[model samples]
Target: MLSIENSKKRVTIHDVAAAAGVSISTASKALNNTGRVGIETRERVKRVSVEIGFRPNALARGLLSKRSFTIGLLTNDTYGRFTLPLMAGVAEALVDHGVSVFLCAIEDDPAMGQIHVEAMLDKQVDGIIATGKRIDRSLPVDLSNLPVPVVYAFTEGRADSVSFRSDDGQGAKLAVEWLSRIGRRRIVHLTGPEAFFSVRERAAAYSAATAHKEPVLYGVWSESWGHEAVARIWSAPGEKPDALFCGNDQIARGAVDALREHGIKVPEEVSVVGFDNWEIVAAQTRPPLTTVDMELKELGRQAGLTVLALAEGRPVEPGVRKLPCRLVVRQSCGGQPSEK
Candidate 1:
């Protein structure tokens, strides 16, 4: 065991070797059961190593093994703002498995994602994790054609490659269900701009959420657009919608602002819902906004795991690896039952 008083004298394979009365090579071979070492000696060395605090140096092992142990992160974000924590979860999951990481942010252009994907082919990345909406499925997906696995985060891969994505339909369903649970039958949906895949799916899901009902849906991607949509809804209705659903939290935030400005009370008079949990910004609202938790971190983690598999000449998973969305109840939505 490590001595509590001697923090400087950290345990090493050499210390285990000395205690076991064996050369470093013997200790290494014994620990890894490599280089034709005897089983009994290996067992004794392992036992002694376990007796103290000894850990194999993963970097050294990775170096010797010629496995770059690095996964390339491809994205078009100008800066790795949201991508950072998401990548953190994926990296933590990979590093424990002795995988290293390489990250590159492409310019905000769709072409940049394509260019980066080609660039990664020349680099020593074992796999790729493409993030953000700007990533063109057509560009980096050719890597899927290679022996190295490729994965995508918060983005979609081309049809030519196996891709993993959150089940946006499920997320949409969850948002609607939560609103339904709180007596928000007369709901309104405000979405982001129509260019992105998520925007389209979320729109479909939102519209579907109001099937057989008179609920209204306004498709727009920005807060300004959300404000406009809300304004339009109020102009028509005497009182306005009982609930609101947004494509993303940004739009939801704007919707809430517009509703409050119009002398409408959220949840009590009108309930609001949004996708993408985004707790940092959502919680700070005067009345914390009730939103759906898309679990982006877990989505990134799964994307990474699938990509690792593809890099190994293995079959990549087909179909949506649908992630679940949670209803984050806050002050913005009413907990009471509805009349209509």
Candidate 2:
């Protein structure tokens, strides 16, 4: 592993000049792409700098150029839970390109928009990335009018804002297909709290994927929601479902616990599948879980890159860029591929 401390030794224009056999000012122009330098020499200087592991001091360079070289991140509390990994992916990508990130979580009213925006502007952030999942209702309409370019992740901005969307519909279809492959026709759905676009897309996918057989849908994203859904299922007087598809692993875990209390056998009497391959919760369950991995980190990275492009005045695709989701099969869903 290359130690950052080892890599942090300053590599100045003088060093690049000495290495590239060019004058100091010529080295500066080539490395910063400022002033004017021959294209061939510029490329040679840049290549040699990379070879020697030269990293310019981001702050001093920004001061000279008058660009902050930083992006401000705004998100809800789950930013760490759902947004952090994506942020990590985004940060990794940005670091290579020499950008720094400033992050803050907004949990209250009048603060998400007014307060956070004021702070970022005060610091002169070059761009802004806001995570939309679990967004508090207080973000003002005028928040989009920030002086710098602003991007939203796991969330959308209003009016001419470019955003990235998760492929939940596709994820739902994959989940349903997995269940169908196991010969589980009567699949039930557990959903997240009402009216989220993600829940709606998943429901639509469920409807589409099971259109041939008409599977059932129910439940929300939380363990409590799963508990309530199971109680309802237990109380209803009808033929029991063969499988339960949950909105996320949290609900599936809760449902699994409740099923045991009701003497139901998982993957035997009932099979279960869920969304979001939440490892901590997914890995620790009694029978483990078969769930869809939405690749939130990739999603965040995509959103970050998109926003950076827009900020840089580069053209980006107008419609949503859907991130990929993978299905992770485990013991909870009977370990049997659906055939119907």
Candidate 3:
């Protein structure tokens, strides 16, 4: 037996065949389940191949199967906070299909995006999944005329392209309705920049749910903005909001800290709900945050499956698909105590 580690030798089909005590042709047929071969013999060959650490060459398999079995993921999110989860989802969704993904971070540079796209095209990727930091924004390159199928995930797409994104309105409604059910009437909406598409969508949902008693507070998507928003709302000293619905977790965390500084008990004095159930930020809060989860990973999985379907010539309905979001219950909303 070849000592694969000591000899630094690549295990081949020939080695597998020899280990299985069969001819190369017979071994190939048995391993591939092609031609005529006894089931017992096929199982033996497979077991021997595994034992000998035989790995078939992907390029050779592609040549025979007429597919590279590779896909490209284009993104401008260098930080990878959003990209990593989406990529993991895509990988999980395509695991059964035996497909691999190539991630390209263009960093919002048009030239860089084109270079990555061309490189992937040269490698003959089966399809491309274009994603970005913002759902309303497009990647820096053009995928309109690629030879392969392209799907948009959390990124803007051309008119006819199939795209998947979070349902911002539904997620906001879940948070607002939950607060309302818990008897929170004086609700205030604090969110990010008004120019952002998601902010508008969420604000609209909050207003509709609350009947627009107080105006929506639009500011930066940051902890500082959240801190300042609380100050501004309390400065007038009218009827204080009993509940605050923030656009994202960062803002909610800031609000919680500010409330504590002002001697207010969370959920006891003022309930808070945030969007984007980012565990890193949400779980670290004092009482933890009750936030709406956009289910980004699920969005990526659906995008991956849709792209693969397009690549395989399967009929996939074109147009934007908004996936549903769910509420993640935590202590911030005066819910039951969580298990430690």
Best by lDDT: 3
Judged by TM-score, which candidate is best? 3
- Write down the lDDT of every candidate, Cα atoms only: 0.72, 0.77, 0.91
User: In model 1, how large is the Cα lDDT of residue 267?
Assistant: 65
Q: What residue pairs clash in candidate 3, if any at all? A: none
What's the candidate order when arranged by decreasing lDDT? 3, 2, 1
Ranking according to TM-score, highest score first: 3, 2, 1
Name the lDDT of candidate 1: 0.72
For model 3, the stretches where C-alpha displacement exceeds 4 angstroms are 1-7, 15-25, 38-48, 337-340
Candidate 2, residues 92-193, lDDT tens digits: the string is 768876777888777655545577778877877788877756422323325656788876666666547766667888999988888888889888887886
Error of 3 at 223 (Å): 0.9
**Residue-wise C-alpha lDDT for candidate 3, range 177-281, written one tens digit per residue:** 988889999999999999999999999988999898979999998999999999888887689999999999999999999999888899899999988888999
Q: Please identify model 1 stretches exceeding 4 Å from their true place.
A: 1-25, 35-66, 79-82, 109-123, 134-147, 215-219, 237-239, 311-315, 336-340
- Which of candidates 1 and 3 is the stronger one according to lDDT? 3
- Candidate 1 structure quality by residue, lDDT tens digits, 1-340: 8666865777888999999999999999998878977888889999999999799875676567645677888765546655776687788778776776777877656576667776766655777876765322433334456546666666666555555456677888878888887777777777765676676676678778778465445466567876888888889847557888888777888888888899888768988777766776688765777777766677777777776676656786565456776667777886843332
